[model samples]
Target: MHFNFPRTLGQEDAKKRLSAALASGRFPHALLVHGEPGLGQLALLLDLAQILSCEDTATKPCGTCFPCRAFDASALETLHHLIPIVKNDRNSGSDDDEEAGPESGQIDELNESISLWHRHPYGYHVSEKAMVRTSQARELLGRLRFAENEGRVRVVVLPWLESLNDNSATILLKTLEEPPANVYFLIASDHRSGLMQTLLSRCLHLGLSPLSASDFRVAAETLSQRAQKPFAARLLPFAEGSPGLYVELLENDGEELLEEALRFLSATSDWRVFADYAAETSPGAEGMERTTRLLLFLLRMVRAYQLLKATTPANAGTRIDTAEALEQAGWDDSLAAYLGAIDAVADLQAFAAFLESAHRAVREYSKPSIALVGLFLEYEGKANRSVPA
Candidate 1:
């Protein structure tokens, strides 16, 4: 099957610059691609790799070329994929368990993960513990120092560069400083704030903004076809322009969660409905997980509501003209009713703060149910107080 990357979804300017870089043979040795999670960083990296390795002398990445076919078949000799691994807590081995390298089992598992990612990059949610350890970095350095096997340009694709540990960072920094003749590094990360300044200074940095609504719609169509599932119109508000996050939600039964979240928010003005939902969802770990997802959806909605609130006219008084605000924000009718239920900016802020706190408390506290129940009760009291008689 031919796996395609959705280039039009976002990052138009970045793509143009990349194309220019390729056209000019004077591209940097290392590139740091930073963007929010689910913004197609890895897919862009793979696209660059394919472009660099394409054998066709004419149009770049003529997918029919030998190197392009090899890439599609997962047999590309010039490209290497690197991922991080953390300490295995389940091994029950001694601390001195020789630095012999990642176990064959771990390597096999990681390779399998990479293969799945190749098939569906956006659908493949990255592992939480995928951190690049020192040994892995050392091994990568050794491989990159060697001459290319194909007698062509070599590429090392590094995603989640922020996960690089101190030792690994040191080794990578050395590599970035020195000259590797024909090798290039393509690094992708979610958060650039955590990356080392020295490392940032060594490479060409390209920052990708979140996707626009129109672009997201186009992307949703492509993702829908790839996933073989019907697209839900409700996902736009929840996705907040992140296609990767949207795919993640889809994998996690996003349609059901969206329905539940919208229902919960709609019931905000009614105590009985809110109470019933709390009773059902504040019972156990599984219930808490669902509650957490609902709260995350709520947070996104509040953020959007806040955007709508900001555009309201000051002379419009305490009671917001919801229609006018929606018009000002260019929000579609889908979100009008749901957002209108939010009485005021103060209420939305308080609601959002509560959701964040509740999410944090559930993750941190031992008894999540108790914490969440108390949280909902408090929010209910505040929400009731906010309503006019």
Candidate 2:
């Protein structure tokens, strides 16, 4: 059926490879697509699943077929989805019970989520706390036990498979090891390391890379037009070539986050100021989400500074001499100015590492105020040691 793929950039190679495999009748029954969270892995997985279940042999997804129409309307009987959901203890029914599916409210939420994702895959966001539970896995397994039409394909699309808990993963692994006839599993994961090795071995793996700058620009521009928002090129470097992330930044207060990141850097010049800023922006449990986004912006700046230092001629002597030089190197105006003012390349490198450590710490429930204070103290110590008496 006539379907519009998400306006994600790049992955042409991946599309070609998948199409070739399908054409040759060598497509893997369980295919695992892994990449960074915003690299469009889910979008690609959905496209592949739709193509696999298409009724048209000549054109594949000939747009007018029943399967194609069903898919478009999200009513395909053979197509299924397994998405992460908030764990509900009260709804924990026996695995053997056929009626122990998600509650009607959960089902409504799931359907709405899928609908929104279909409209704008890149812009969709799943709650970090949601995960695939054992009950959901058991329900899906129950559905698969029944026989299907001969020669008809049934596709199960699972996005964020990394969210599958240990018990749920074991349930899925059993099926992946010995899947039913004419069934395909299209799985996508943002964090491959979180997945079990046994599960990894059962699927044909495809890794996707971040989009190129040109492709990112095209995707960003398209999203901007559809969103009716002004395109902010300065946020491009922060996006690190992920259109999903780019869209996220655009929709969220990305510009403000960048500005706050710059302010944090400026505060580094004075211990008292830095400490005050740290205290003010300290992400107690409630602010952790915004703090994480701010940290990403800071990390992006640090990396950009590192790249600028690495690429400049040795004669430049680790100093970004002018805004013009940074601009020439493709930095936006604000970022160029910030990079131009920095001379401590070594300190920035160390700070980048610290930022990474802090990011992990915050995600692991460490106090963000302590992390922020630690950053200031560490940088101040480095600054003091580098200066002449």
Candidate 3:
């Protein structure tokens, strides 16, 4: 497959390192790419994948090979995609690959399915709903047993590798440890605690940092012609480095939700509304989950703004760059009132225990409602009055 590296944002150092690996011919078979959730990690990976699978052996893909042409035309579908899905025989979907499958049931879903993936040599996105299932893992094992075609390498990219449970991981461990000669695993994740040590040792690590405001603007501004400039720029300051996330917010129709957030913060005079939204007792499960995730994004944005403020002061007032984005997003100004000096970020680890407990509560088995409340409670109680910076 052929791909053109996105001429956008990010640290040139990262690109240099990746390029150096290619030039030196020391590229790892499996790579662990980690960093902030919305910082163009996937886009970088897509470019890297193109480089690896390119038809031209002298350099990057020539984009003229048959496979490259297919990829360029967005007609290639050679990816063996996997992800989480909760299916019951009782439901509309059946497991027969010969029949129209779930991933092929809808236009969007069909494009992400394994059939199209195997035909295409380019980007293949593993959906959040496609959990690493035992059946899927076993299928992966079976597929890898055969030799690849055209002297090409095959890749298995998992964005949220942490989602795999113990059984699935163990099954994958066997494959990861002794992968085929040309098979590669590109696993990206936000939660490292869940991954095992052996698994970590098996892959090369590529740590990603958050994108600066400039790169953020490019990533977002390019989303649509209607919305340009600083508006798409909003996501850069707040996201965890994953454009997938910013895109998810866009795809999920987050504008209304963001509006509600702004309104709720402004109307905080009614503490009940704040409490209702905070506890998530008022909204249903879907609303609660989406809103909670959005709030979490806002909180991260606030942190990013704080970091920006400490480094780059603006105006005579306390007008931090990214902070203004947070305020615009509707974070309660009262929280900022309590926000200690920028020094507080240095001691962020001091509240690790509280955060860990809350995370465990949520990841393990706590009800969504309880988990949401417990998480924020931990945050409210643990943020110290003193700033360590």
Candidate 4:
């Protein structure tokens, strides 16, 4: 199968710049590609990795080289797909979890990995890695321990950079600050808020916009011949520019409305609904996971809007009218509140970690519901908290 990097309409200009950089032989050692998911951000980076490592001297991954062949066979171990590293207790300083919930001592597991590529790639969900702990960061430093005699470039590709915790992120700071001879660091993350300012300054930043509604329509049609036009109309707006998200909605098995409602609440206060969703999600592991994801996406999108809009947040309503409702509901203060939402959403993983306690509470074996209610209250309170004095 052809590994197609489906370029969205507006992304061609960015591609042009990368092409120029390659042609001039001035490729930066590390590149930070920031964009919404579903824009083929990972695909572009993978293709770039091959192009960089490919023996063929072309602007693209010269369809002919050991690396290219390996890429085609999906056997290429060199292009390291680096995702957010979370800290897990099992990871007693091993580097395996770095790819999935990534941080430092995380080892990269090629087989049995939990991506959709194992079956229907489109259906893949990232396996949660434990939060990248300080030990994990040390594990990552271990990867660079050996020196390669060959000129092979092992590219580490992390899809979401914002997932790295403060301790884990510091490990990257050293490598990013210094230049390694052949190793390359290419990270693709949408959450700019979580990244360190000095980290942002260390690499070439490429901002990628999401796909247009029409573009997604064409993609959906191409993916499935029987796609309905009206479905695109409904889905495109919610994709929020990411074709992947649009695709996810179409495959949502009748929960599209719920997803949309969640998205709306995340973008705006919709205080009552969020409070209820949080309450509803608190009692069960599955419910909490789902609600937590909604909160995460909501925080991310709002943060994106916050950073991109040149004017006050009130003007950001031009994109999402719900933002205006939120502003009217008194959300027009510091970005700290928006950030709090991200932090709160991220804590759901902690809820997941304590699933046994939750299950006990759900079964009335323990007071899980009370604990959940407390968690939701904390989330709501944080959102309601204005910039502290």
Candidate 5:
């Protein structure tokens, strides 16, 4: 049940701003933290809660304090956690909490998920299965109407705000309009654009940008040691300044996948091999995200190749300032030969265009393997004709 504030990594500016506000007693009643996926938005929310409710006035979240421990353990009576859940089609809006015996499974399932998140705030696995429904939002409003327990400030943390269904969002907007006294709401999300515009205006919006490479490196190293896994240092550049993403890629065998990607691109002329690679790499429901990850890596490589080729031969040795920039716009030294083999500007552009199309298709819910294979077929048709065979 221990946590640290300064150690939140890559969020010093944000931490400082919030800490100052808290110390000055001028913090907002409702706040929204938004950023790219895996930026530790939930962790930040919990940290702020612990600090705000901590007994030690000077040190703020003295992790050993009762309130701090409660927040860390997620056992604080004053804290309410609301998350997304799939509607039970079989039991339409049944009060699962009041349901008797084994029928109370929904409440138990929700608690178990919350427990996992509390134990591993950063590395917790969020299921893509459920969503926030209006019933849950109404439940939250009902809870807020009651006075705070233990005489402490009441705090509600709602992570993944965009998961709220339309009805849920509408109910949430009403609560935001007239939030209960001594009760504060903190919502975090990666999809700000999807949020209701009226809801956005009510909360103090805080934007968390991607971390710096130095911070990302430190975070990756820490997570690697904690998870007892090897860190792929080379993938740091491609992680785009998000340590969470770097850890994800490292855990999912990103190094090997990228190697396979390079090979696949080189052998694009062979339809059978391309199809096989596409099929194997296309993740099913649980890991369907692999497709998007693959497409991102491919885009980075293609873009890097294009930029490097565009630069003067003498200036090609120069380095970009940031890891993000280097990954997106610079070529890997080891891949120089492969890059040279496909250095034809027109050909690279064509390939990049098709890759873009494939990326769009995946975003639009297309079958990834099929979309990628189709792209390969199209490219191969032209490639075969252009070659004297």
Candidate 6:
């Protein structure tokens, strides 16, 4: 029986370590996989879950066994895959609505999400508004009440552990403290700090590093083939070391976001224009996600600008061609033009720092318009100071 792990880039060391542990029968009952998105943490957990439930011990998952087949079909009764979901108010009736569990529509959405995740674990995106509800946690506890099968292991796969609200986290903490025999919890989170310390203490933590350049290229190529699209080489620098992020940029109209970032930089000269842009771009919850993406793109651009400025003739005492720098960074013509426009007046480092802070603010659910307006105002002041009045 062969273990069927997802086709992901890099993290070979982590995988080997995990496989060894599983083989030695020393694997942790509760494992926490934490890393930046695109590092394939969820894929690792999914594979682990299958391995734990596999009826065949030699070579583990042995994808042919009934347990393995059931896992593949998402019909494994012992495998509980949990994800954050928005609660439906319409499903609420009694005061014990928390026990009512997910509505059929919600369940359908979850199943669909799981299906997509199985197909492309790295590229899958959950709704930003979705969160682990107290009711869902309660349902999980209820399911665990039944006696475990003598020889089979039950696996609870929870992704985005940081999305659990206080009540949900508290409810699950008990199970984590003393999980049923033969029950293992596999949890993944992009932001470990957002989780409770008590919860963190109960699990064996594994932190995945970013992919190397070569690994990222291979992963990108694989995903490109799967997506039936050419690799967007221009967006590679923006993705840093994350193929998941690369896939996201490829599918999420990333070029539009880049154009918007350029527009934002160009608008910084006029307060009214910048304010208008902010208001127009950030209207609501969806707008907040878009704004966050835009901010990340801008932050990357700022870093590029800093690099360019540091290597410029005036600073480095060497004539470094702007076009050469742009090409090396995989930056396009629009970005080149935007950087040139701000070259003299922008304090690249300070602006980059501000952008980073603004990004954190947006992620913490601050109003996007407010964060954008503040960012613009701050940049405007810096630009004004650099200009000759």
Residue 68, model 4, lDDT: 80
Which residue ranges in model 1 land beyond 4 Å of their true spot? Answer: 1-8, 90-98, 148-151, 266-285, 308-337, 343-346, 374-389
By the lDDT metric, which is better: model 2 or model 6? 6
Candidate 1 lDDT tens digits, 65-88? 898899889888778877766557
Give me candidate 1's TM-score against the actual structure.
0.84
**Minimal lDDT window, size 10, model 1:** 1-10
Score residue 35 of candidate 1 by CA lDDT.
80
Candidate 2 lowest-lDDT run of ten: 1-10
Return whichever of 1 and 6 wins on lDDT.
Answer: 6
lDDT of 3 at 369: 49
Candidate 6: tens digits of C-alpha lDDT, residues 1-389: 24446554678888888877876778898999988887888778888888888888567678889998998888999998778876676744642355567779989988888888777888877666678888888888778767554646788988788778778888888988878788899998888886789989999999999787678778877888888888876666577678888888888877787677777777665688867866776777777777778878888666656666564545463434566667655455445666665463346656777678777877775576787678768876876786578
- Across 265-308, the per-residue lDDT of candidate 5 in tens digits comes to 66665689868876776777534566666667777667545455
Predicted candidate 2 versus true structure: per-residue lDDT over 1-389, tens digit per residue = 23333334577778777777887788898999888888888677767767777878677666678987888788888888888876566655642223456777778878887887767777776777677767788878778767544668899988888778788899999998878888999988887886699999999999989887777788778878877899888888778788888888899888888778767676666778856765666646657766677777778777666666666665265466546656666757666655644454346656777678767756775576777667657866876686675
Of the pair 3 and 5, which is ahead by lDDT? 5
**Best model number under TM-score:** 2
TM-score winner between 3 and 6, please give it.
6
Per-residue lDDT of candidate 4, residues 1-389 (tens digit):
11223323336667778877877778888899887666666556666777776776532566677888887676776665544433456655664444543424444432333243323333334444534444445655556545444567777666567666776677788877875567777777667876799888888888878655455566655534333423443334335656566666666632445354345446434445544645666666676555444544443444444443433455553443434444443333343334234333423333233333333344443444466455545554554563243
RMSD to native for every prediction?
Answer: 4.0, 3.1, 7.2, 10.8, 5.1, 3.8
lDDT of 3 by residue, 260-303 (tens): 54564354334345456656542465654565554554455346
lDDT of every model, 2 decimals: 0.74, 0.75, 0.55, 0.54, 0.70, 0.76
Model 1 global lDDT (CA atoms, 0 to 1): 0.74
CA error at residue 236 for candidate 4, angstroms: 2.1
- Candidate 1 residue-wise lDDT at 234: 57
